[model samples]
Target: MENNLKMKDMILTYIIIGIIALLGNWAGYHVSPIKALPGMLIIVLITIVGWGIKKILPINLPAVIYISLIALLITTKIFPGSEWIIKETGNVNFLALATPILAYAGLSFGKDLHEFKKLGWRIVVISFVVYTGTFVISTIMAELSFRFTGKF
Candidate 1:
């Protein structure tokens, strides 16, 4: 709990981040007035699902991992009106979604300066490699799918 933050502070931080991300998304992506509403709803629902699953299952899963699962379940063809949802939510650049999360992650990491120093350069190297690989792999996959669909 060394790095513990007040609950209200955390909530406020997320709200501020969310608003910034919302504005960024709005400016970069054209959308109807109601598009942001669904994005918010989806984000909240996915978070709820993740928390609920974690609580009930007594698992050590993080919300983000479960949220991705929930998102995948929702995006399938079996989900009614998923096509419309995909169109709207797809417009929301997830890069915007990531900005605050990554910022928070960095701050959290910074909290344990002593532990971080103990880890030395190994963690830094690993993080760099992991992030680089993730970016490269995602780009390749995106390009492949786009090219296959003639959307590239």
Candidate 2:
């Protein structure tokens, strides 16, 4: 019963996330004619969805949503067209948006920083390896894709 409940909660969380993404895409498509409006709408819709899900759902989500909202506001209001924001905001946005979910994960996983200390070196080594591997693979793939399609 506990496992089933956990599975159900996981499914619900994914559904809500999907809804948020769809709404963002919809807002992006509809608001494209106006500069910044689509992005703004995407951010607004995501925040609303995040808040609504938290209110309605029984599961504890991560703090990414709150962080995402903050990042979005910063991007749209302060750094609207900065090259740094343009190039890196998407990645940062995911981290920010995922804050709530991450928080939940942290709580579910024990919420004690000291617990992670035991695995410190192993965790760091694995994370570094994964990050570097992903970066290299993605870069190579992106370059190849651009070369093949002449679009980038």
The reply for model 2, stretches above 4 Å from the true place, is: 1-42, 49-112
Residues 15-119 of candidate 1 have per-residue lDDT tens digits of 666677777676666544356766755665565666566556766666578778888888899998788778767756788688767877998986788776788
CA shift at 13, candidate 2, in angstroms?
18
TM-score of 2: 0.33
Winning candidate number (TM-score): 1
5-85: candidate 2 lDDT, tens digit per residue? 344565566556544544443454332223433443455445555555555667766536654765565557466564445
Error of 2 at 17 (Å): 19
lDDT of each: 0.71, 0.55
